[model samples]
Target: MVMRTLAASLLSIGVIVTSMQVSAANEPIQPIKPVKPENAELVELGKMLFFDPRLSKSGFISCNSCHNLSMGGTDNIKTSIGHKWQQGPINAPTVLNASMNLAQFWDGRAKDLKEQAGGPIANPGEMASTHDMAVKVIKSIPQYQAQFDKAFGSKEVDIDRVTTAIAAFEETLVTPDSRFDKWLEGDKDALTKEELEGYKLFKSSGCTKCHNGPVVGGNSFEKMGVYKPYKTDNPAVGRMEVTGKEDDRFVFKVPTLRNVELTYPYFHDGGAASLEEAVEIMGKLQVNREFNKEEIANIVAFLKTLTGKQPDFKLPILPPSNNSTPKPQPFE
Candidate 1:
């Protein structure tokens, strides 16, 4: 009798283990891996550039101005405040996990972070400084040239090098180890019953069709209003601006939902104010389905579980400006 009981216990344990393995394998979303350390000097240089408002024409706006690290890697506003307090055309996406994106920008115009880094510096609405001027300003700073030598084996600072440093630093801003990742890793208790149910609904409702991957999105371009039109006063033509094709109208790169709870108001236009509203809007516009109150609530709970550990580091202290440093022409 004792032998039979022990055999039965072993069998049950085997079954449970197999079940957990299967459950893990069946999930579409993957956990974000922690960013491995790259060149320390290069990353440090990038960090300084990321924080230095000298990259902007006004000398007051930095990358952190729009993508604030303390506030879930986003500015937490409907639209970003840009040069001369100008409202940006579209809402700013969070910089956290942006390195995982296949392409940068809503239109996917810039091929990678390196390419994207040079854009806002010259964009009239954003940073409003020419790349040539940006380089000249950085070159004027002797300390920056020293740091450049340490990073790139040369003191020669150019726009390409400047963007490369910024991109290198941006790549380090990844968030990992969320509660959902714990659940995905086979810790069955990581999520509440409602949250788990919500995950099921999220998959069944076709949210995972676009939002599948380590970052839980940013994998492909999708039309925003598949089932119906997404009404917005914002005049972004989406990927049509990039491809210049009428068929690509309303198409945009799906944004990451990794830290959705904190990165609101939601959407390219910042139309939806709350997660509940966002979920409902997504369902109706993307999937042509109307989720009830309970469904929206549970889905939101699951989304909250995706808020992972954010990047932690001391703010970089920038080099002091000297007489050679180019003056910021904010008014002119």
Candidate 2:
């Protein structure tokens, strides 16, 4: 038997596969739809751009370095280590259904993927390059310059085209074919009885208030400690840092529960280590009740059901050998 790697542990956080519940009371939860292959050629081009390390200051790290599709779209670190091995203050969120979010990033700083894509590449702690530097680096290679023109009709590659290509690729990263989706589609026998019971406990426990709907999350932002503030001497200034509003302090986007099984070290801060412990912490910090071991176990089981399927794409063979001058190495 193959031993479970970080991927398995991330994917098996709970016990069963599950789906979003739609009711008459409010808007239906809709998982992000897969991007139409309307332009298969562009998607393919975007795919290469997405994987090409040439976009980064460090030749070694592509978008995949932090957001591995096989690894729940996150590298499972509390905070991302960027260029020069510098640590980002915020947790690395999964990129799985990020296109659905109204704002991207833990602090809700970015307005769209096109906007979000450029953040890390130039963050002082991340890829660390100016727009001019990045454009110049990518354009140094004739192949990349040609691909840029092909992808965006721009012989002169700029920050806009680069981020657009990456964002276009991200729009295609939706994962919606989990067993839970199958169950939602009328496959009554898809989930086991225990898993079904766990789903009940998940809702009754009030997890669904903030965690319901498709994409499972990605709809709204809520303060972490709704009932009571999470105790911290130096809590990460979540939404407040962005909005500069005291009321918005500690607010965070409710993350999609899709593939929650594989994206553990849960919560905005990644303080919860195990599913049970995470549940325990949520109850105390947010829900105001201690979780019984079995209930916690069941909730974990239901969360597993949210692990949807994703399609694999081929990685780009690099050295960007076809290109002329190599892009500047961001992390090197």
Question: RMSD (Cα, Å) of candidate 1?
Answer: 2.5
Residue 184 of model 1, lDDT score: 87
The residue-by-residue lDDT of candidate 2 on 196-292, one tens digit each, is 6777777777777787777877778888887667765436878889989999888988888888888887777777667778777787777787888
User: Candidate 1's error at 11, in angstroms?
Assistant: 3.7
Cα TM-score per model: 0.95, 0.86
The global Cα lDDT (0 to 1) of model 1 is 0.91
lDDT, candidates in the order shown: 0.91, 0.74
TM-score winner: 1
Residue-by-residue lDDT tens digits, candidate 1, 67-106: 8888988898888999999999888988899999999998
- Residue pairs clashing, model 1: none
